[model samples]
Each structure stands twice: as structure tokens, then as C-alpha cells.
Target: MISIGHSPDADDLFMYYAIVFGWVGDDLEEKFENQALDIETLNIATIQGIYDVSAISFGAYPFVRENFALLQTGVSFGDGYGPKLIRKKTTQLKKNFRVALSGVHTTNAIIFRLAYPEARIVYKNFLEIESAVISGEVDAGVLIHESILNFDTSLEVEREIWDIWCEKAQEELPLPLGGMALRRSIPLNKAINIESTLTKAVEVAVKNKKILSKMLIERGVIRVDEKELDIYLDLYANKDSISLNDLQKKGINKLFELGFKAGIYDVLLECEDYFIPTGYQALRNS
Candidate 1:
């Protein structure tokens, strides 16, 4: 049996549904068991090597790279958008202003830190971030995931993490947000099979997006209504999600490199070196 861990959020639910709905290889389907948790919880479990395969933040990769290899499929990238920093319309942040971040391991937090090192950060659940900002408990907060979709009118966007990313990246590369990680201790052959299964699952989901999205809403796996769900999925689970492209690999590497330089990681890593060897199948066929 293989255990798969992922977030319960809409994009994750959308991407993994093909496997959950039995659209992949039958044998692989029977062996699969999935666990749904919030992203921060999954990131912690992934670092502990608690699941055979788990979803993780790109920001968390540097810490877990020693034990897990990232899966090339089921990724979320933002081309011109991402997490948003929000504050009351009249609020003006001074240096060292307190900002609420979803989690220290979240991609948004990493970008926020790089952009505003002078700010003081406090961690909170993503669900509670908006309320904290509105309650006057924080000067600003970074809104992530579905929180970015709908927020209180009293709060205005201070800045988008996408803009922060663009300034930091200094080129046209999508921001690498989150993706799957598989335990390296799994024998190499088994790791390759799991990787291929996940890649196929993402492909199936993208091809049957309408049916899957409908099922997701009916099942209450998605929090947003149909219209918002459509928009949210397009943002995070669109074509870029089915597989990682060269540009995304570069983005992921840049994320790790910057994090390492900033002391977020003990060592620098190249993302390509950590992927499962799907090339083995082509070699066998040749």
C-alpha cells in the first residue's frame, strides 16, 4: 500500500482527483491511500518523513531535500499573481511593523521575508489572517490560497507577493509555490512507479477538469462556489500544473538558492537533481 498526503484546498483537490476518482491505472489505484490535511500540517509531516508521498511548499523544500525528492507533476505556479499583503485602508506600516504570515514554512512567508526584512512577523492560520488584520492586531498580513480570492473590503492590498517575486527574480519566471515530494528511502524502482502514477493522475485531471471540478464541489472538498472555484483552479491548477517545465525548474532553483543565501536553508540545492528518474521508462522502451 502507498500513502499519499495532500492539502484539502481546491487546487490540490482538483489536481489529485483523477487518482481519487479512479482515472489512473487500476492496479495503482487499488494500492493508493490518500490523506487530506492543511498545507502547513502536510509540510511538517513531509519533513518528518511521515508519508510515502506528501505535498509541500517550495519554501519548505530546502529543509526536507535530504530525505525527499520532488515530484515533477502536480505543481502550482503563478505567472503574474500570488499571495497578497493586506492591511486596513488607512493603515500605514512603519519599519518593524507587525505582519501576520500564514506559516513560517509557506512560500508567501518566504517572499514576504525577502521583501520586508524590517517587518516583525507573527505566524497564524491562513483562515485567521484576515480577521487578525481587521481586528487591528496586525499592521498587515499576507493572504494565501483561497484567502486571496475573497477578503474584507475594509482591508486593502498593500502589495502582492508576485510583484515581490518579480523584483527578486529579475526575469520572466513563474513563482514556484508548492508541489509533491516522495520519500527517497522508497526503493528507486518503486519511487519511479509512484512518480509516473502521479504524473498520469495530473494529466487525467487536466483533461477532465469540468467533471472533476463538479465532483469536487458536490463532495464539499472545495470551499469556493462554482464561479470562484473555476477562477481559483485556473490560477493554480491550470496547464502549468500537469508537469514542471524548464522555466519552473529554474524558478524552483532560484527559490532555494535565495533561501540558502538568506539562511533559510543549510545548503543550496538544484531541483532537477532531486526528481524521480522517469527517464528509466524511455530507456527500457528504447
Candidate 2:
């Protein structure tokens, strides 16, 4: 049995897996009997599974590299809709602003620091970020995940950090959204099989819009409109092809450089080991 962990944002992959793996039927029993896949929410604590894939962020990369082995690469989701630096319209920002993040050690926080070195960042769960921004607890908020879609309109978008990275790099950098990975102990064939299955699953999901939409709603993780989600899934999913050369590596490298410039990562070489290039030159060139 293989155990895969990923963030809530990666629910699309899970939905695709269910569709392609024959794991969903009129009832749950038939689904489970037909498919031998298991999935769970990824966290820092669950890094030791025999076969593990994670939606690694900046903070998680250090942990994954220190613990797991590199495996096949996956598609890039592109720089996320750009993390929103939101502030209450009434708030004054004469001084360096205070910001709230999902976690201080998360990729969002690192990107925030790289984009605004002088700002103060604090940790809060997703629920608290918008409230903090609106109630004056924080002058600005760095929002990710579904929070990007659910953000209150009253708050103003001061800047998009990923846009800054794009400007600096002069290319559309992949935001290192997430990928499939395996534990060092897994048999190489098993890992390859899992990758192949997942890639095909994604393709199936893309073709079956009804199943994909139902999966998203059932999961309750996506707050965006169905049209938007459809567009996103179509753009990001191409299961027949797997490439690591896109924005994921380049965007990550850019982020690493920014992290070094901002003094967020103490050892740059350590960060370098976290990126494993998958051999798809088209993705690299794109």
C-alpha cells in the first residue's frame, strides 16, 4: 500500500486519482475494493512513510530533503495567483507593516520576507488571517490556498509578491506548487507505477468534467467558481506528460536566490539539493 500526503490545495490531484483509479462508484464499498490507493493530508510529521508524495512548500522542502528520496517529477501549477498582500483600506502604513501568515516557516512567509524584508510576519491559521487584516491586528496579510479566493473585497491588494519575482527573473516562474515524491525505502518500480497511475488519472479527470466538478464539491476544499476551477485544472493537468524543468525549478531557484538575498536560508547549497530536475526539455524550454 502507498500513502500519499498533500495539502488541501492539492485536492485536485486527489479528485483525479479517485476518477482514474476506479475508486469511485455509486457506493463507497465498490470504490474501495476496486482501487488500492490511500491518501491523507500532508504534514511535517508524516515524512517517514514507505511511499510518500507531498505538496512541499518552502518550509517543507528542508524537511523533505532531510528525510525523503527524489522520485519522478510532475506538472507545474504555475505561480499561484500571486500571494495577496492585503490591507484594510482605512489602515495607515507609514511604518513597516505587520502581516499575518498561515505559518511563519511556510513558503508564503518566506516569499513575503523576500518581497518585503522590513515587514513583520506572524503566524495564524487560515481562518484568522483575513480577520487580522480587517480588524487592525495586522496592517497587511499574506494569504494563500483558498484564502486567495475567499479574501474580502474590502481589503485592498497592495502588491502581488509572485509578480515581483516574475519581474526580477524576467520569466514566468513556476510557483513550486506541489509534486509526487516517494520515501527512500520504496521499490523503484512501485514508485514509477504510482507516478504513471497519477499522471494518467489527471488526464482522465481533465476529460471528465462532471466527475471532476463533483469531486471538487464533495471535497469542500475549493471555494472558487466551477468555471475558474475548470480553467485551472485544464491548464495544470497533462497526465500523459511529466516535466520538472518548468517554473517549479526555476521559480524555486529564484525564490532560493531571493531567500539568500533576504537571509532567510542560512545554507544555500542545502536548498539546492531540494530540487530534482525531471527530464522533460519541453517543460524546461516552456
Best by lDDT: 1
Task: Kindly report which residue stretches of model 2 are placed more than 4 angstroms away from their true locations once superposed.
Answer: 10-16, 19-43, 46-51, 70-76, 168-170, 218-221, 231-242, 266-286
**lDDT per residue as tens, model 2, 1-286:** 3455544453345334553346433222212112222222243433544335554454445445656644334443444464677888777665468888776555656666666778777878756789998888888887665566556878988877667657655677666544455565545444445555655555556566566666666766565667666655554454422545544655666766666666766656333354333333336458
Worst 10 residues of 1 by lDDT: 21-30
For candidate 2, the TM-score is 0.73
Reference-based lDDT, residue 194, model 2: 53
Q: lDDT, candidate 2, residue 215?
A: 68
Report lDDT per candidate: 0.88, 0.56
State the displacement of the C-alpha of residue 23, model 1, in Å, after optimal TM-score superposition: 1.6
lDDT of 1 by residue, 55-111 (tens): 899999878888998899899988899989999999999989999998889888998
